[model samples]
Target: MAGCDVKNNPTYLLVVAGAISDGAGRWLMHRRPLAKAHGGLWEFPGGKVEVFEKPTEALVRELYEELDIEIDPAAVEPVSFAQHDAVDDEPGIVILLYRVGEFAGTPRAVEGEGIGWFTVAEIDGLERPPLDVELAAKLGRLFPE
Candidate 1:
């Protein structure tokens, strides 16, 4: 059906995610709510970049909304990115991963999602979403075992 032709009417989403690490080398991870996309899967903390908002701006807002943390945009350092094609009927997504070098306030799950701090050795064991899996690999290289 022409209406089902995603190639002709593709939708692109810009999603921003953060890897907030403690100085001791542990990262904060968020588990997607069971009712949300990739339900029950673990991921970096962040959300969709709204129109008219920069990715860093969106990330700062998302961290506050999802984790109750206030992060300075200047503290976010671009680390990696992933481009995923459309799956099933869903639109394609481009996810940008940033390292949160500094933030004020402790992280707490404010959006009903599970939260945990994981070390590089512990990351491989977590059931992370696809995008997060890629980001983790890159992160692992930065802090080899």
Candidate 2:
């Protein structure tokens, strides 16, 4: 991983979660593990998308895999998109954010970490993933309550 640059490119799946529950507009967010980069900071739960997978399709899989919740792809609405500058020698990613206005099941950190739900306004208060915060700002514009 030395001498390799990962920026302004695609090597990760940038995802945003509108963790709505029972019709409320809160979102699900998590704290990155200490061993990971940006550790201890809050971030919406999601990760890199595999090649040849649609964003919606990939999101469903990721949510299930990482968060242990099943997401209906059709329930996902594209609210915004963003491209992030890479950090820590990591590849830049195209983060596509969608509003999951309707979904089924509860969200839990199936992977390994702390997780929670916050209202749109509360997002900025949390120390969030640098890239995810960008998407959250865009989401604010599309969903003004």
lDDT of each: 0.88, 0.70
Q: Candidate 2 lDDT, tens digit per residue, 31-98? A: 77778878888876666666667778877887887677777898777777778766685856677777
Model 2, residue 35: displacement in angstroms? Answer: 1.7
Q: Least accurate stretch of 10 residues (summed lDDT) in model 1?
A: 1-10
**What's the CA RMSD for each of the models?**
3.2, 4.5
Best by TM-score: 1
- Point to the candidate with the largest lDDT: 1
